[model samples]
Target: MSVSDPLLKSLKRFVLEFRTTNIVVTDDNENLAKLCSVLEEIFQKGIKKSKFFDKSDFFWSWVAKLPSFSKERCNPILSMVIDTVKESKKVTLDLGRGRLFIRSALMKKVLTVPVQIIAKNRQLAREVYYENDSILGNEILAEILQSLLFELTEAHFQLRIHNASFLDRTWNLPIYKQYELVPCDNLGLHVQYINGFLLVKAVEPGSVGEENDKIHAGDVIDELHGEALRGNKMSAVHNILQRYKGLPVHIHVIKGYDSQGNLYKPIHHLIEDADIDIATADELLQVKKSTSNGYKKPPHTILNEEEAEEIPVHGSEGGASHEAHYLGYVSLGIDGRVVRIEDSVQGVLKNHTQRVPVRIELTEKEVLVIDIKDNKTLLQHAYTEISACGRRTDQLQHIAYIAGETSCSLAKKFNCYVFEMKTNEEARFALCAIAQGFERTHLLL
Candidate 1:
């Protein structure tokens, strides 16, 4: 039989789990030879004497060599292999979920093969065996052994350790910067605690932080408003920001990159001794309390009763709406809004997959797609017209929905509208809102 035939048969008969088992073979030639001998016996039994052989044929033949290879037999073989390599002081075995992941404790190299335990009747069992790849020749076996042992030897480990220590001692340097930032729209800074410092993860576009040009993502905020941020919880940072709301705050940051623009070594290398602190409810409550009392309208500030009543707040009773900025429809060729569809809107969109800036708004009864620059409604669809709406997983920051064209009855059809959001989280939120709109419409019906 051809190689493809038996491989197809095996796949159809048994579910091939792509899970792996890792084993670290010793650098010793004697142990490697013994392991190769055992593997050769299995491969010779399965492979027919032929000039040409494929992976599928080799795999099936190996399986046939141990038709009754059970969990009991699997453990002993793995233990024996482990014992043979134990003298190297680099063997580590991780067994779980009927799988094994073997690797050298000191090296980054790894070899993965399926080690599943199945039944004699060609049926899958709860266990697995390490079976894949044929022991074709001594060269192949020698190559595999060499890869596992190349950097795992004692001499290599000692040399690497010495080099790393020398570099750390001689090249370590500190880079710092100070910024005076005025708070605008919540400072627009999102931070995460990493390596004992509050690392700025993102800076919101158009915010004061971004406008400053000095503050940036990846910079570690070592001190905020005269308070050292290191060894402090995120809540502490929040509390400090809240206390100094609407005021220019002084910030001292340890630059993630050096003066030469190259990233610092500590940013990429793990610091084993850094302590990561977890936030508690008390800290969260303190942040909320500080925020509530942080901002107060000036004594001269006053609002008319009508002005107060007319001011729109999101999610309010008077038809409040949700809006998000998106890189507009991929199907639309032009950057501007589609004010009128002289031809088929679907046809125009289907012609190309280009994106432009747009603003999406969800109102009481309709969804409006507007051009960001012109501020004109390009396309409007009622909740009832929407056939489907969802965020695309393939493009994490993209959202897609199918809606029927209400205008131009001559060629009325459903168009797939695709828009890319600023972030995946925003895309997900937009999808959820669209789903809620559908649900509300269903309830009204």
Candidate 2:
């Protein structure tokens, strides 16, 4: 059998959307079955044949079994088909840590078949309820079945490529490069110890470290004179550098940014004032101004009456002041003697109930909370460790709170942290960003 002209035309339009060359359309059942099997393989093993409407009986039975067919419940499947065919609506499906979206009329028609079959069979009761010509014929159905197979194959292939691109852009392993520097008077580099890594905080001009074009402020000094600098204190690193003064020191460094402009993960959290150049400083100032504008009042409210009266309002005379309050959050260190807002959610964190004021930042792999006053890192949780996050409803407008739970590896316990943002939009943005980060981490794995 051959496909009818009407069905062939419809199928060709769908095929053209994928821009696939060497088009072939036939009504051979064996070829159609092979195509369906290929689609199943592409989607991975054990995908139900009914998922793509490969079997005629299964398709009909699925329509008959729909809860919407009982008239009391609404049929979302039928509604999706109608919306997709008429308005070119698309539907997203979660697939292996990524998402797959489809917006084809032919696929929608194939999805609507079972419902149409059930409705027609019900109306044609007491008579031979054969397949209707208006809905779908056998030959045309074969062509559509083949078309859907190709559509899904192409869509899945594109989704894989997209996910790979995302992984390439977001998650990058640290690439180490070696540089041999001969100090004249000094190495002329200011270094800081952060999370057990020695980071080049600044490179003085006319120094060997600055002369080396590849070295930058955020580059990590992984090794010095073939000795690992990790887990070494600043004094130890200083002693090593002094021992090798005026001598060629072979060191291994992790570049802050790769050739393709991908930043190292550690650079995101360890950025300091010295790392900011003129252009970057201007950009950061603009961002700070915008963030400060979001909250006309302070980001946190003191629940204790005595503390509230004692502490003056921010920007008022004799008010408590600190650097980097750009986001309107109080810049209290982790151990500062400030009374914090009590957490509304119980048992989120063991022996921790106070919602401390801090600045929250999200990277591609982890969420970092930094003290706004001392710039100390209070919490760092990988996305894999974070089980879930969402907004808390007990707060007032413009005072959005977010809570996330992280599983501790050493203690084998869950620790929950709650953050307060200036606006509801900011809270939602943080929640979505974390969710996307979590999904990307799993996709890479």
Candidate 2 scores a C-alpha RMSD against the true structure in Å of: 24.8
Best-matching candidate per TM-score? 2
Give the poorly placed runs of model 1, Cα more than 4 Å off.
1-314, 318-354, 406-412
Across residues 1-445, which tens digit of lDDT does each residue of candidate 1 receive?
Answer: 1223232233222111111212333332123323323332433423333222123323332332332343345444444333333322111221110111122212222222222232232232111222233222222332443333332332121111111111212223335555543222255677777645566666665454554244555556767666766567888878887665433346766555554455555643322222323222233233334434664321110011111111222265423333444433333232111111212233333564556567777766667888778889877887666644543223555566556655212224666576667776566555545544554554555
TM-scores for the candidates: 0.24, 0.25
Give one digit per residue, the lDDT tens place, for model 2 in 337-439.
1112223222233234355556666665676777876778876777666543443333422221222343322223443355556665455444445545554
Error of 1 at 109 (Å): 46
Q: TM-score for model 1?
A: 0.24
In candidate 2, stretches whose alpha carbon ends up further than 4 angstroms from where it belongs are 1-171, 272-445
lDDT of each: 0.41, 0.41
Residue 325 local lDDT, model 2: 16
Q: Model 2: clashing residue pairs?
A: none
